[model samples]
Target: MIQVAAAIIEDEQGRILIARRKPGKSQAGMWEFPGGKIEQGELADDCLRRELMEEMEIEIDPYAFFGVNDHHYGATHIRLIAYRARYVSGTITLTDHDEYRWITARELTAFTFAPADVKFVEMLHSSKPRLNE
Candidate 1:
């Protein structure tokens, strides 16, 4: 199983960040929490921090283990681990995605996310989750 890490990045205003996959990517045009696959000997948190820096050119302080989802598309199996993260600093520059946005949780249902992210979206129907506030 492929281990992937995702960040549900929330800003001070409670807006969560989402990224749209570029055309050449696997799930082209689909929106998702910005992150990448975990590498050997890397912790999920470290992977998230590294991925956010690499993919969005931003830094984050990830916290509160959110949830996990195991999914299969055709033959590809992935275990997506998510966490609530605070946007620390940096300008938004998407490297792996075509577009990105900081949206409220309620607006999440409007955008089509990658299948593995659906559960997380559904559970986040309200404003910032009841995480450590």
Candidate 2:
């Protein structure tokens, strides 16, 4: 199974950060969490940190474990390991994604996300999660 690490990035206002997949990419145009696949021998936390930096040019410290989801899309299968990460510092830069936005939980349902992310979204709904003040 493919190992992927994702972040539920929450800002001070309790808004979550989501990225839009670029054209021609898998799940193109879908809004999903900022993360990428884990490389061999890399820790999930490290992979999340690296992917955030690489994909969004932002740094994050995975402060808490959130949840995990296993999904299969027939052709490809992935084990998505998610975490609640604290945004540290850095200007937002788009590398892999076409666009990004900070949206509230109620607004999340408006956008389409990868199937693997649905569980995390539900978790956010159940917990009404917020960042540290």
**What digit string (tens of lDDT, one per residue) describes model 2 on residues 17-126?**
99999998988998888899999999989999999988888999888888889999997889999988888889999988899998887778788898899898887767
Off by over 4 Å in 1: 126-133
RMSD after Cα superposition, model 1: 2.6
User: Pairing residues by index, what is the TM-score of model 2?
Assistant: 0.92
Please provide TM-scores, in order, for all candidate models, with all chains considered together. 0.94, 0.92
lDDT (tens digit, per residue) of candidate 1 on 1-133: 8999999999988888999999999999999999999999999999999999998889999988999999998898999999999999999898789999988887899999999999999989754554433
lDDT of 1 at 75: 95
Name the candidate that leads on TM-score: 1
Model 2 accuracy (lDDT, Cα): 0.87
Query: Which window of ten consecutive residues has the lowest lDDT sum in model 2?
Result: 124-133
How much is the lDDT of residue 66 in candidate 1?
A: 94
Evaluated at residue 12, the lDDT of candidate 2 is 71
